[model samples]
Target: MTAETLTVVDTGRDKKREQGQAELVAAAVEAARPGLDKIPDPVEPDGDGDLTAEEKERLDTCIGGVELLSTAFWIAGKSLDTMAKGHLIRRIPHKLEPERYYETIEEWAWLEYGIKRSRCAQLRAAWALGEVLAARGYHAPEGQVRELVPLKRKYGLNAGVAMYEIAVEQHGADKVTAQRLRDLVKLLPEDLALKDNDDADQIARMFGGVLEHAEPKALSAGGAIPTDVRRGVDRRALDLANVLNRRRIPRTEVERHLLEAFADEEDTTVFDAVLARMKENKGK
Candidate 1:
């Protein structure tokens, strides 16, 4: 046949495969819904020697539905990962308006695939990370790439990107292995994951002094300080108090200083007392 004829034949095959896949996905969803609906009801045998007809039917339906739903969900997750990888590698977004593809992907994920935007974002980030890995001569397996995306998303996008960069820099591109990347990802502080620098900084400042003391005490004593032990102070306050006392400042002294500093301010007594209580609990 001619080149044009061959092209037409290839297109037909592609369309047929696409149609078949769509049908299968629809069938899976349809099958899963019935199972999901029955999940709330308990599937128990009747007190009699045998289960009633309705109970028997419900048990069979619920079990089969759950199994089908589980399999369908697994398949759907794999398919999404594959689609995300293809979209990233092919630079599909560039075919349309620049950056429009990100929004388009979110919309398509929600409308067509019933996935949320956050999940789509995870897939996108995973694909981008996978590309980076491939370029560095570390081709991560498909499952590994998918697994890394959720960890990256936990830190938010900017932080995730920053982590990837940091990992590459700390562990030379050539030396960076999948396990090394996983370890580096885990090292990221939860506070650092906040997208806003101001928020992250504020948290660090608030908990910084307390964390230093609390961590050691918890380690040495082998227990965490329970919150709600004091009227105004929580576990965090207790931690801060412990740290201050470790520096040789007495709880009473700290309380006196705070009370004097806030004497002019109204409703400062509660705050002062909490600090004093924290100091009292220090070292114990």
Candidate 2:
């Protein structure tokens, strides 16, 4: 075919795909409504029971959420009620005839909404973090929202929000980014994944001491922290090895010798406490 004909053919294919996708979206919403309406009266983890008034209210929320999603995926980007959407999307399955509708939200997301489970999850996290940040008066864009997601996942949504506030307060939201957030989260004690402690100031203070010893360059973004904890543990282990070398002790013998010395004690709690104290006082 001529180049002009080829271009027209490709354009036709694009139009066809677009039409099909639009139909798919409409169909998904159409399909979900009946199932949502039929939601067996109750929508708990197990679907055999009936729904309470409170449960019915929540079920409406889920149904309303899908409607909102159909019209405005960008509802996720909006500050108003964005988290409610995220929370619902994260739990769209809602035990609504699991065996009939589909076993998991991921399956429903794929077959019904035509959205990948990964994108579904990302929207859920990003919306949650974004709303939390918005509550703190920062309508963080997707970039910053994306950064805060890891913080939310690692700690809690409050922790993520707290971290965003800290970052914006430190560097202004425009200047801050995913990389900047990652840097901040990394400096947080390697073990700073506290779910219950969402206090921003308290969390901000967590890595404060690490700064005293960490070089300025050390704070520069290393791009990203590995999602796998083992990678971090491995790096920390290597650093510990270097620290051990400074003390001129063999790695294996240190623990072995400690056991030998503490052989008389059935419980090593006393030694563990001492070692913990020594770690706490390392700089001093």
Best candidate (score: TM-score): 2
lDDT of each: 0.53, 0.60
Output candidate 2 Cα RMSD.
20.6
lDDT, candidate 2, 1-284, per-residue tens: 89999999999999999999999999998876635454445434635588767677777867765544423433533422343344444544434555443445556556765778677677665775665555566646676677767767767767777777677767887788778877776655444446484576676565454433333223222345454643454356567768777422222233345456556477787577778888989967
lDDT of 1 at 103: 38
**Leading candidate by lDDT:** 2
Whole-model lDDT for model 1 versus the true structure?
0.53
Q: Model 2: residues >4 Å from true position, as ranges?
A: 1-99, 193-195, 208-284
Candidate 1 segments whose C-alpha is farther than 4 A from its true place: 1-125, 131-144, 191-193, 196-284
Q: lDDT at 172 for candidate 2?
A: 88
TM-score, per-candidate, Cα-based: 0.28, 0.42
Q: How many pairs collide in each candidate, listed in order?
A: 0, 1
Q: In model 2, what are the clashing residue pairs, if there are any?
A: 42-51
RMSD for each model, in Å, please? 16.7, 20.6
